[model samples]
Target chain A: MTTVHTAASAVSAVSAASAAEEKVDTCASEAAHPPPVARGGYTISEVVSHTGLSAHTLRWYERIGLMPNVSRSHTGQRRYSEADLGWLSLVGKLRLTGMPVADMVRYAELVREGEHTFAERQHLLTRHRENVRQHIAELQDTLAVLDFKIEHYADARRASERV
Target chain B: MTTVHTAASAVSAVSAASAAEEKVDTCASEAAHPPPVARGGYTISEVVSHTGLSAHTLRWYERIGLMPNVSRSHTGQRRYSEADLGWLSLVGKLRLTGMPVADMVRYAELVREGEHTFAERQHLLTRHRENVRQHIAELQDTLAVLDFKIEHYADARRASERV
Candidate 1:
């Protein structure tokens, strides 16, 4: 009975290890070509493709202090890390909201200052969120006006046709 | 009896005329200093204040054909009409949505072309409204990300204080 119990426990352990390996494999496959393991570093061209930003714009972002200093590969080309990609993603979203480049640079500065500046970073984001909210409200109001104007045009067109 | 009926009718007529006059006064008062009657001709400075656009920008807009030609007074000073104010208001809203200046110029051209372009104008506005809606959606999503990040910072700070 002791031997049988030991054998069963060993089988269960083997099954569990196999399951964990399968999970990892699944995750790696799901991420495919850009798997986390392979994403330790990216070339400038790779980042340009991933972020859909022009090479010129990426260089400009770096020059304007929007991006932190990128590491260099053996040949001296820019090599962006996972954290850099994450930062670029956030910057892309911020740019969509029409936040000025200067403001983004400020945020980047706060980030570079590390854990001590977390409160300031949070405050900056809160203020920017408020600005975005106000902008969204304004856009909604403008949308209503546009809808009204469009409807007027449609009614006028129908009336003209009826005439 | 006829005299009494005539007196009643006269009273009603006077009340109706007074109501009409009151409506006119209400409208004028609601508009305040920049009443429509007074809006027939605004100087450059007046347009600048009304539109919150710099005089330089106003001139630039005019140069770019984004604005219709302004009339000149006896001394050749530019006089913007109520219609011009209305157009500027529309332009301001469009600008808020980040519509390209060239597109705005096209819209201005459509306006100058008159009634036949109503369909095209409506199409342009409809397209712009869609763009604005998409932009609002993107901003809302970004806001959510910011809120999440802010909450993370708050949590981190709380943890540090506890330590």
Candidate 2:
């Protein structure tokens, strides 16, 4: 009975490995011919072109824990998956709003901690959105000031020309 | 004729000095009783409070030629005039729009060069205004993405709770 149980365990392990291998095969085919949305894997340069981020910034993001651990090729070069590209895209947007690097790292940690941190992640993003709103309002006020000053300059120029 | 010229020059000098003293008296009275709009001369600390800038930053502005040479008191302390405060206010607004310090210094120089630089200053401000507009549009787009992600998190939380 003990021998039969051991055989059954071996069979289950083999089945799991086979399933993983099948998934890898699908990934391999996708990697060979990348889609427009970047489903499979990409090189560092490919990611740079796709995301418009410099290679230095990308490496810095990885070092700062703003990015998840990227996969590696057999020769030990970095390989970025589609999921990585998606994360980078989000990071790029967050950066444009001048979100602090530390806050971005915290958000990344929440992402890696799984689905339970969703609520907390939402709260972080909501707070940042409010900040962005305030910044937009301030810029609008500055714009109004610029408009007034520009008109004043126009009048001054005309007056000088008349003189 | 030399004696007459000397007497006339001395009289003119005394008249100019007296006028300046009278202006200082008015400024001293205003400084003694600070107003809401902050006219007259202000001490370093007073300017700090009014502009919400640190004393260090104010000095740095002067050092970098971003500000004109502020008037000095008898004790060699900085004394900011109403015109200086007005210039600082405009600088504060420009800083908010992320204008570079070098560009601001250039603008300050143009102001000091008299009325001839009006067209150039106006051009610089107009270009900066365009940049601000683009920034605002990009931020609005990012805000939309944040809204979408926040909603997704909400739905995910609800789904998990049901499970």
On TM-score, the leading prediction is 2
Q: How high is each candidate's TM-score?
A: 0.75, 0.76
Q: Which pairs, if any, clash in model 2?
A: none
Put down candidate 2 lDDT per residue, A1-163, tens digits, no spaces: 1111122222232223222221232234345455523443578887666555678878999999998788877788788865676676666667666677789999999988998899999999999888788668757877887898899999999998998
Among residues 3 or more apart in sequence or in different chains, the pairs in candidate 1 whose N, CA or C atoms overlap within 3 Å are: none
Model 1: per-residue Cα lDDT over A1-163, one tens digit each: 1111112222232222222221222223445567533544678777665666778878899999998788776687787765666677677677666667788999999988889998898898888888788778768867877899999999999999999
**Local error of candidate 2 at A126, Å?**
1.5
- TM-score of model 1's chain A: 0.73
Q: Lowest lDDT 10-mer window, candidate 1 chain A?
A: A1-10
Candidate 1 stretches with Cα past 4 Å from truth are A1-40, B1-40
Candidate 1 per-residue C-alpha lDDT over B1-163 given as tens digits, one digit per residue, 9 for 90 to 100: 0011112222333223323432222235544476534544778987665555678877898999998788877788788776676677677667666677888999889989999999999999888888888778778877877888889889999999999
Top candidate when judged by lDDT against the true structure: 2
